[model samples]
Structure formats: structure tokens, C-alpha cells
Target: MRVAVYYPWVYLRSGIERALIEIKRRSRHEIRIYTNHFDPRGTFPELDGMGVTELSRVSVERTYSAVTAAALSIVRTRLDPAEHDAVLVCCDGLGPLLTFANRRKPVVNLCFTPLRATYDEVYRDRLLARGGPARPVKRAAETVFRLVDRMAWRNFDEVICIADTVRRRVADNRLFPESKIHLAYPGVEPRLAVPEGASEPMFLLPGRIMWTKNIELAIDGFRRFLRDAPPALQRFRLHIAGMVDAKSRPYFAQLQELAGGDERIVFETVVSDERMRALYTQAWAVLAPAFNEDFGLTPVEAMAHGRPVLACNRGGLRETVLDGVTGLLVEPEPAAFAAGLRRIAQDADLARQLGAQGPARAAAFTWPRFVQTIDAVLDGAQRRSV
Candidate 1:
């Protein structure tokens, strides 16, 4: 069957883009992507040859006007029902608005999470705390958006959540009944066997560089770790690697400032897949500091490389990382992470023990498995429609 997948932006090497690439490569069905923005040079090179259509010229700006414009365009756009057997929406934002115009086919939504600005109380509180004079305006907009978002969700035949964290958020919002929602975890690629050797004294933080990533916590924690760690551990370095988009340049700059010209804290932006894999293999551990991530791919990727993870003990990380087993799960504060780093660094045997169990734990999540689940969901939706 032919499926049209709608996503708002395809400009970053994000988990959503990775999922799209894997689905297209592994699924039996023909998958064509429809998006408001597409930047081949900025995202995965694998997307170059895939079937992708740009719905409109939309800038990836976070300003209210730009966001509102994109939302209007998405809701107004329509797809030809004759061209596709089903519609699959990859939604974290206004991408769900596609349901407003395309309900003729079997519509399935692959939700990462409900919009954090509206549905996530913690995130909404953070926004309001920093909202200044526009707090009232922001609150009003959120109320209106929640109504529209719920309406869009009602049009979908089914909603596939990437993690139970996301499933809970959707269910708690009353956007969809339990029967319409399903859970399908995303997958990671298997890494080649690394020759047994001492890992480099490095902690790698990998993902898109955005405010939501909470990168400052990692940087601050690393600094605190270095201040009192042993001489051998003091030599350890922290590397931050990921895609940096136009909207997140300011956040990236802020992170650089927080690093304060420290040589041990390095920033590498828009790294290649090969380089990313190499980083994972060489590092002593991986860092995941995001607050309540929908379902983090970094921790799983780290585990696939036989590397331990130092992650915030919240959200999907709780599901993926078993504290004191596969990796150390700690509070999001700098002090907590600093202590975690010291513990891993001081005990070589402990680190090795954690890393040894990683590959086996990671083997359960594979691209083939993820694609099979998606294909089955699409097929089921189509059969019900007929």
C-alpha cells in the first residue's frame, strides 16, 4: 500500500527524521513524505533519494507569527485521496492539522508527544515563567491550540505512540480513547563489534542542540565533576555533538558561553553518521539530560554501541535505562549528574560491568521490528476503512 506521511519539518537529523528514513527503507509499503520544510543538506543524506514533497515554503522560525502561519498552511493543505491508500501523520506539532483536510483515507497518527507548550504542564509552566509581558497572550493561544489539536486528533482512525510516556500524555489529555491508542517503541541500528580496549576518557552528549535538550545541565555537571575528580578522571572530556538549526543557533550560542572557553567541553555540530558512530564507540559513557523526553534515541544508540548512559531519571529514559543496571539514572540537577559522573569515572570495573550488559539490552529494539509494527498498523487501518 502507498502511504503519505506528513511532518512539519524535515530539516534536522532528529529522531523523527530517523524513524521516517527507517520506515521508508524497511517497510513493505511505499512511503512518501509530505512536509512544510525540507532541507536536504541539513538533515540525513539518506533522505536525498526518498520520495519527499514540500507542501509549502515555511521557515523554521519559533516566532508566534511564523508558527501561526505554518499552522494555517498545514490545516489548509489537502492531499489527493486517489494517490494514496492511507495517511500517516508524524506529529509533535501542527503536522496533525493535516487531518483537517485529509480524512478520506485511513488516517493514522504516529505521535511523539502532545505539544509540550499546551499539554505538558511542566513545560507550559516553564514557558509562562519566562513569558514576560506576553504571558496572557501565550495562555490564550495555548487554550485555542489545545482545542484545535484535540479536534485534529479526533479525525485519526488510530494513534501510535512511540513510548508509554507519550501514550500517557495523550490519554491524560483526553485527546483519544484507550482503544484508539497503541504503543510502538522506536528502534536502533546494531553496531559492529568493537575490539576490546580501554575506552577514551570522554562523555558524549548527542542530539539536536535545542533549549529543550537541557544541555546546560550536562555542561555544568561536567564542570562540577572535574573540580574534585581524581587526576585520571580530571583528564576526561565532554563532547557535545548534533545538528544546529537556524532556530536553535541562539541556544547553541548560550551553551558555548556556558562552556566558558573550557577546552575539555567541545561542541561539534552537524556531524556525519560515521563520525557519530565512532563517537559512540570511543566514549566512556553517553549523557542524556533532556527533561521528560518523549523517547530518547541517544540512550538506545549508546547501548547499541556497548556504552553506558548517564541520563535524567524521568520520562522515557525511565523505560529505556535501568538505573544501576544498564546505566545510572539521576536527578536533572547539576549536583546529581556530577556525582554520577564521578562514580562511573572512579570505578573502571563498574563502568565495564554496565557497558557489558548494554548490547544485549539494546538488541530488543531493531528497525525491522519497528517497521513491521508500523506496516501492521497501516494495514489494519486500511482494512477497517474498506
Candidate 2:
């Protein structure tokens, strides 16, 4: 099937980009993508080779900020069923537009938590969350955006979230019935996540330094874990690696104060993917304590490398990480995370066992499986269009 997938914008080689690459690789269907901006060097280099059309000439800053690009993409990347057999609206800020532009027809929504900034109530509380200094202005903008989103959401014939937890959230939205929403789990490229020999006692927290990511929890938990841990477990260290810039520096400093100059707690401001893989390969376990995460990719990616993960039990982590199997799940609190830290640190056998089971569990969430689910969905949509 020939599908015109709407991505709207690309800023980084994030989970969505990775999913798109995997889909492009595994699917037999012809996919001509639409986006406002495309920078292969900054984002996925593979995107340069893909059948992607640059929808608009947007500035670099505007491309990264969804508040700036949302209206532009909505007004510009408007899709019609006549242009393609089916449409897959899988990108940020593009969902409302694609569904709105499709003339109330069947449009597929591959959601990653329903536009957190626009829909999330907590977003309006802070400036960094909104990406600017205009609170009242942004709220007014989101009010209009919400109206458009609701209208667009009603047009979606089918909706797919990356996990069952997210599927439930989308189902509860009331715009679409539960039956219309489905679960199409995201997968990791395990080959790139090549595991090393027996790992050292190191806990790696890999993600953005945003408040939502809760990097402070990792530092606090690790500090508490070491206060009463066995001598053998003392070798364990916590390494935080991801994009850290001027915006993140303040949050990063807060985490530093929480660490209290502990050598065990580490943060790398300029860590590359290769460095992250190295950390993944050598680490005892991956830690993701993000509260209410939609579908965490870090835990799955860590599991793909045969590394055990100690993640929060909330949100998609519950589905992605098989508790007491691939890894241990804990509540999103300091004590729970500290307890998990202690358990993984002290019990080498249990850690190894969890690590051994991780790859097999992660294998089920492969790119082929993800692509197959979407293919079936899009194929059905195409048939319905006919």
C-alpha cells in the first residue's frame, strides 16, 4: 500500500524517529513522508534517504518548538485521501491537523501520549514546560489547539498507542471509543545495543534532563541505596547520560546538589550514543523512574542489551518491563527506587537472571512486529477507502 505518513517535524533522533526508521526498514508498503523540517545531520541520518517531503521551510528554532510549528504544520501538511491510499499521522503537532484535514474520514493516529504540552494540565504551570514566557498567551493558544484536536480526534477511525497503558488513556479520552484504539508497541534495534562481557556494578539513567524525567530521583535513590548497602555493592555507580544544555543546566545543578558531591553519582553533559552504548554494555542495570511515562524506550533498549532494568511501575513501564522477570519494577518514590537499587546491587545471581531474561522479552518487541501491526492497520484503512 502507498501511504503518505505525516511527521510534521523532526528535531532529534528520538524514539519517534527510531520507530519511523524501523517502520521504513521493515514495511513493504510504499511510504512517502511529510514533514515541516528535515535535518539528517541533527536527527536520524537515515531520514535523508527515506521518501520524505519537506512540507515547509521552517526555521531551526521554530522547527524544534511545537507551539511555533503546530499551526504551520496543521495549515500546511493537510492531507486528503485522494493523495494516498491511506494516511498515518505519527508525528508531533501533526495529529490534530492530519485528522482535521482528512475531511472527517478514517485517519490512523499513532499517538505518544496525546500532545503532552497541549493536553497535559501540568504544562501550563511552568515556563520551560511551555517553552516560552507567555503563560496566558500559551493557554489561550492551547485552548484553540484543544478545540481543533478534539475535532480531529473525532475523525480518527483507528488510534494506536505504544503501550496498553497509553491505549487505556486514549480510550478514556471519550472522543473515540475503546474499541477504536489499539496497542502497537515500540521496539528497539537490539543489534546496535551489542552487549559486552559480565557487567560492572553501575546503574545508568539514560534520558533527557527534563523535570518529567525525574533525574533527581536517581541521584537520591542511589544515595539512599548506598547508605546501608553491602560492601560488594559499593562498587555500583549511577551514570546519567542524555542531552544537557542551557535549559537543562539548572535542573542538572539541582541534581548535583542532591548528589552532595557523591562520586558514585555521575552526569555527562556531552555523552554520545556510542558512550551510552558503552554505559549500557557495562552497567549492572538501567534505571527509569520517570513518573507516568507513556512508553519508555530506555528500559526496553537496556533490556535489548541483556541488561536488567529497575524502572517505575507506573505508565508504560508496567507493560514494557515484566516485573520480577526481565527486571524489577518499583513505585516512583525514593525508597522504592532505593530498595530496587539495593536488591539489584546485592544479588548478583538475581541480577544476572533478570539480565538473561531481558533479551528474550525484548525480542518480542521487534521492528518487524511493530511494522506488521501498522501494515495491517494501514492496509485495512486503504481497503476501507476503496
Candidate 3:
């Protein structure tokens, strides 16, 4: 089957782009990507050969004006039904708008979470806390977007979420029926076995450097950990590494400012896959402080590297990181994370135990399994259309 996968933007080596790359490489169907913006230099190099088509020239900006323009472009753009048997939307933001013009073909949504601003109360609260003249305007716009977003959901034959957390969000929001929503966990590449050596007294925070990551929480927690930790753990470092996009540069800068001349807090941007693996291999444990992430790939990736994960007890992290088992899951607060970090740092045996169980658990999520689940969903959609 020929499949056209639509995502709003393909300009970051984040989980969504990585998932698309894995699907294109592993799926049996002929897959082609469609997006509003495609930047070869910024995203995964593998995408260069994936036959990605840009529907319109849209700059990668997170401002309201830019998002509105991109949504309009997607709604107006049409895909020829003859070119593909079905459509798969890599729904993150406005990508579902593509279904407006391509309803002629069966549409399946691989939802990363129904737009966070509209569906996520935590995220909405944060935005509202930054009270401004635009608050009323933002609320009015969201009301309309929510209506349009739910309307677009009517076109999706099935919704495949990355986690049960997201499945519940979609169902609770009434964006799609709970019965039609399926969960397919994303896969992480297995890292080559690194010899068991003493890990550095370092905690790694890895993923796209975005505001929603709540990286400041990690920084604050690390600082708190350092103040009360044993002298031996005082030498511990916090490394923030990941892709930095245009819009997120400000947020990244804020994080740097939050670090405040502390050489212990290092920042590495747009790191190569090889470097990321090295960071994971050297770290004592990985940190995930993102606010209700759809389905965190960093934790699974860390587990694959036999590195324990210290993640917030929210969203998809709960599904992946088992507290006191695979890794510790604490509140998304600096004090809570500081306590969790202290425990992992002080008890080497506990850390080792958690890391030991990681590989086996990570092995359950495979690229082939993810693609096969998607393949079955696509086939089922096609059958219903027939």
C-alpha cells in the first residue's frame, strides 16, 4: 500500500521525526512524507533520502501568526487520492488539518497528544499564568481551534496513540472514541553494549530543548542536590544535550541563564547520534522533567543503554519508568527530584540494580513491532474504506 504521512514540520531530530524515519525504513508499505516545512540540515540525515515532500513554504516559527499561516496552508493543500491508498497524520499540532483536504482517502492519526495547548490543562495553566493582554484573544482562538480540531477528528478512521496516557486524553477530550483509539509504544534503537565501567557522577538531560521540557526544574533540582549531597557527589555534573530550533533558542537561552555561570551545568546543542549514545553511556542516570510528555523516548533510550532513568511521575513517563524498579519516578518539583537524585547518587548498588533491569524491559519495544502495529491499523482502515 502507498501511504502519505503528513506532519506539520520536519525540522527537528525529535521523537516524532525519529518515529517517521523508523516507520519509513521498517514499514512494508510504500511510505512518502508530506509536510509544511522540511529542513534537511536541521533534522535527521536519514530523512534526506525518505522522499519527503513540502506542501508549502512555511517558516519554522512557534509564534501564533506563524502557526495560523501554517494551518491555513495545510487546510488548503490537497493530496491526490490516486497517489496513496491511505493517509497517516503524524499529529502533533496542526497536522490534522491536512485531513480537511484529503478526506477522499482513509486517514489514520498517529497522535502524539491532541494539541497540548487545547487538551492539556497543565500546559494551559502555565500559559494562563503568564497573564497578558492577549489572554482573551488566546482563549477565543483556542475555542475556535478546539472546535475545528474536534471536527477534523471525525475524518480519522482510527487514532493510534503512543501511550495509554494519550489514549485517555483523546477519549476524555471527546476528540475520538475510546474504542477507536489504540496504543502503540514507540521504539528506540538498541545501543551497542558498553563495558561495565564506573559511570561518571553525571546526570544527563537529553531531548529537544523546548519550553515544555521543564528543563528549569531539572536544573533547580540538580542545584538542590549539589547543596546537600555528600562531598563525593558534589563533583556531579548536569549535561543538557539535544536539538535547539529557532523558536526554542529563547527557551534554551533561559536555561543557560538559569545555569548562571555554573560550569557544572553544561549545554550541548544539536548533538550527533553517536555523541548522544556516549553521553548516555557515561551518565549515572538520565533525567526527564518534561511536563506531561506524550510518550517520552529519552527514558526508553536511556534504558536501552542500561542507564537508569529519573523521570517525573506524569504522562508517558509513568508507563515507561517503574518507580523503584526500572528507575525512580518523583513529583515534577525541584525538591522531589532533588531527593530522587540524592537517592540514586548515594546508593550505587540501587542504581546498578535499576540499570541491570533496563535492557530487558527496553527490548520489548522494537521498531518492527511498532511498524507492524501501524501496518495493521492502515490495512484495517483500507478494508473499512473498501
Candidate 4:
């Protein structure tokens, strides 16, 4: 099958890229990716040879760039199943909006979610609350985007949500029947190498420094954990590492203030991949306190490296981290998170037990499985069209 893929951005590493790479390698399909921008050096260089076309006409900026591009992309490009047998949208946002090119072809959307700006109530409210006249203006703009997104989604032949949480969201729309939606849980590359010796009890939380990440809650829980921890655990450190931007600086500052000169609470704004693996190897467990992540990759990465993950018992985390087995899941509340942290700090044997199971659990989620799931959806979509 000849597949035309549409990914909205080529900025960062995520589960989408991992899945796409496997799709290209394993699927018996010719592929071409359409997008507004793609930097081979910045993203994976392998994408350059994958027939990615950057629509220079679609300008990418900080805000409204993706929604704008999505609308423009469908208007500019013309697609036919004769030219391309399937349309694969491997994007979280905007790409679903490109289904306007469906034209009776099988449109299989690798939907992580609808455009988050339009669909995510919390993200929309937080992002638009600037004050007075500007707030209303932002709200109006988002409303238009949401309308466009809902309209475009109607054209999708199939929507594959990467998690059950996302699948449920699509089901709630009822705009499309549940039959068109599916769960294609993303998988990870396995790398199990348990550390040689017991390192200090360190908790690693990694993601973009955004309010959406709920980094503050992680910090709050870490502070609480430190207060009552034993002398040995007192030396334990909480490492917060990820990319940061100007808009996120204020939140980073608030986290620093929350720390209150606690030397054990370390903030690493950026780290090389080598450093990240090193941290994961030596850390006690990956801390994922994101309030309700659609699907988090940090915990998976931690587990792939044979370390346990302590995450909130919400969203996709619950699906991956089996409570009291592979990892412990706690409520989003700081007290609950702190208690979970404290449990691990005090119980070294429990930590080791969880860590020991991490690799095998992560192994079950393989790239082959991810690709096969997606291929099955594509086959179904094609068969339905016939």
C-alpha cells in the first residue's frame, strides 16, 4: 500500500516517532510524510530518506501555527487512494484535521489525541487565561480551532488512540462510532541493564517544564517525602530534568521556591541521552506525578532500563504500571505521592523487587507489536472501503 503520512511537527522525540520508524521498516507499504517543518538533524535523520516533504507555505510559529497549518494543508494538497492507498496521520494534533484529503481512501489516523489546544479543557483554560480582552480573544480563536477540528475529524475512516484514556475521549465525541476507534498502545525499545550496586535513593521526573506536566505536584511530594525520611534516605535526591523555555521559566522558579534550599532536590533543565540513561540506571525509580497524562513515555523508558516507576494512578499510567507489581501507582494528591515515595525510600527490598520486574514488563510492549497493531487497523480500514 502507498501511504501518505501527515505529522504536524518534527521537533522532539516521542512515542510517535518510534512507531513511525517501525511502520516504515516493517510495513509492506510505500510511505511519504507531509508536514510544515522537519529538521533531519534535530529529529531522526532517517526521516529524510522516508520521503518527508516540508510545506514551506505553512509557516510554523509558537502559537496557532499547527491549527493554521492543518487548515491550510488540506486546502493545498490533493490525495487519491490510487496515488496513496492509505493516509496515516502520526500526529497528536492538527494531523487529524488533514483527513479532508480522504476522498474515499482509507484514512487511518494515529491519533494520540485531537488537537490538545482545542480538546484539552485544562490546557485550553490555563493557556488562554492571560487577562481581560486578550483572554476573550484567545477563547474565540480556540473555539474556531475546535470547530474546525470537529469538522475535519468527521472525514477520518479510522482513529487509533495510543492509550485507553485517549480511546475513551474519541468514544465520547460520538461524532464517530466506537467501531472507528481503537487502542494501539505505543511500545518502547528494550534496554535492560540493572545497576551494579545500590545507588542512593534518587527519584527522577522528566518532561517539558509545563504546568500541564504538573511538575509542581512532583516537587511538592518530594519535599514532603524529605521531611520524614530516615537518615539514609535523607541524602536521596529528586532530579527534575527536561527542556525549558521562557514561558516555563516562571514555573521553574516556583519549583525552586518550593524546594527552599533543599540540596537534595536537583533541577537539570537539559541532559544528553547518555546522562539520562545513567540517571535512570542509578535512580531508585522514575517519578511521574503528571496529574493525568494521556500516555507518558518517561516511565516506559525508566522501566526499559530496569528501574521501577512511581506514577499517579490516572490516565495511561494505570494501564502500564501494575499496582504493587511492576511499579506503585498513587493518587494525584501530594500527600499520596509523598507516601508512595516514602514507602520506596524506607523499603529497599520493595524497590529492588519492582525494579527486577520492570524490564520483562516493558519487553511485552515491543515495536513489532506496535507496528502490527497499526497494520491491522490499516488493513481493516482498507477492507471497509472496499
TM-score of each: 0.97, 0.87, 0.97, 0.87
Candidate 2 off by > 4 Å = 58-69, 79-83, 91-94, 102-106, 118-142, 190-196, 245-249, 269-274
Q: For residues 96-160, write the lDDT of model 2, one tens digit per residue.
A: 56565565345688887776665444333543355666656766767786777787787776777
For every model shown, the clashing-pair count is 0, 0, 0, 0
Residue-level lDDT of model 4, residues 1-386, one tens digit each, is 77877776665444566566678887766767677667675555567687777764454454556546546865556655577888888757667656665556878778777656656665566666644567876777777866777787777777788887777766775545777677777766544433334555788887667777888888889888888777877888898887665556787898888888888888987666677777887888888887777888788777777777899888878878878887899988999989999988788899888888877787766666777788888888888888
Cα lDDT tens digits, model 1, 216-306, are: 9999999999998878788899999998888788889999999999999999996998899889988999999998788898888888788
lDDT: the better of candidates 2 and 4: 2
lDDT of 2 at 1: 71
Model 3 lDDT vs. the true structure? 0.88
Relative to the unseen true structure, what is the C-alpha lDDT of residue 165 in candidate 1, on a scale of 0 to 100? 88
For residues 1-386, write the lDDT of model 3, one tens digit per residue. Answer: 99999898898898899999999999999999988889999999999998899887786776789888878888998988999999999987787888888999899999988888888888888877765888987898899999898888898998999899899988989988898788899976544322234679899999999889999999999999998988899989999999888778888888989999899999999699989988988999999998788889888888888888999999889998888888999999999999999999999999999988888788777677788999999999999999
Model 4, position 142: C-alpha lDDT score: 72
Ranking by TM-score: 1, 3, 4, 2
lDDT of each: 0.88, 0.75, 0.88, 0.74
